[model samples]
Target: MMDYKEQREWLQEYLPQYMTEHLKDKNYSHFWPVLNAEWFKWLCFLTFPLILFQQRKILQWTKLKSSAKCPKKESTVFNDMLQPKRRAKSKAEIYSDIYYNKRIKPLVKAEEEVGNLLEDEDEDVKAQVHKMYEQQWRTHENAAKTNVLDDDEGDCMLDAEAITQGIDDLSIICQ
Candidate 1:
């Protein structure tokens, strides 16, 4: 029911009093230019992390809980687009493997490949995976564009044996 100006005043009054300087010390009273410059610098530097913390808190509070999210059985928008990959083994087998994955110390590629396989399919349930996929897509596109200039992969060969051995040697040996 409160109007805009009233709400603003209420917020100004409700803010912490001690942290905010007393009424007598609002401006240049507290060491003026030098102290104010340092305060401005500190505020500017802290804003980035403070905003990040606020975003994390908003995500934690506003986002749906795991059980409340779209279930695996129901095909959702994301599942339709990605054509979700199926699990290779039973849940028990996979759980057992994961329990050992840390102890056994999986290779990076194996761990990454398995991670891709285990991702959720439900649209809202899997936003983090989508962001990761987008990041990886950008990295791969950058690499491919750079590779054209660098020719890092050169011409691929269908048959390594033919390239390694001389054609003349093979023809003579066969005869």
Candidate 2:
């Protein structure tokens, strides 16, 4: 039955008291320190950047001292540390390396020989060798087609032989 003004005044006075009493209950007592920790939060916020700055200054000083003490040798220590150490090559890896080296040697040698031949001053010799290569390539291509048509089983062997012969002929011509 209180009038509006009186009700408002009563609530204003009573509400704060009610909240304080209830908020101190055992159930909510633990949350009070955390809820009131604005100063602690500000302390942390201010100190974090200071901590980082000090660390950076320390690192810089250490680096300057190191450089002054010794000229930096080509240090692979850190590089080796950062990179994973390689294990001894496996049998398969060794075999594959050997196979590739053997396979690549001839091609590299052939390239060098061809480079030498191209450097030769005689245009007629280059022309005759080119003609011979073309003739051999055409013959190989024709033989490959005939072998493919006549016998599927022997096609791979024939192609390999043709390639070997072509390489031999090229070596002879280059020499």
Candidate 2, superposed: residue stretches over 4 Å from native:
1-84, 89-114, 148-175
17-60, model 2: which lDDT tens digit per residue? 43455334414344335432632453343435455664355335
As for candidate 1, its clashing pairs are none
- RMSD (Cα, Å) of model 2: 23.5
TM-scores of all models?
Answer: 0.17, 0.29
- What lDDT score belongs to each candidate, Candidate 1 first? 0.52, 0.58
- TM-score (C-alpha, index-matched) for candidate 2: 0.29
Task: Give candidate 1's error at residue 29 in angstroms.
Answer: 99
- Which pairs of residues collide in model 2? none
Give the top-scoring candidate (lDDT). Answer: 2
Q: Cα lDDT of model 2 overall?
A: 0.58
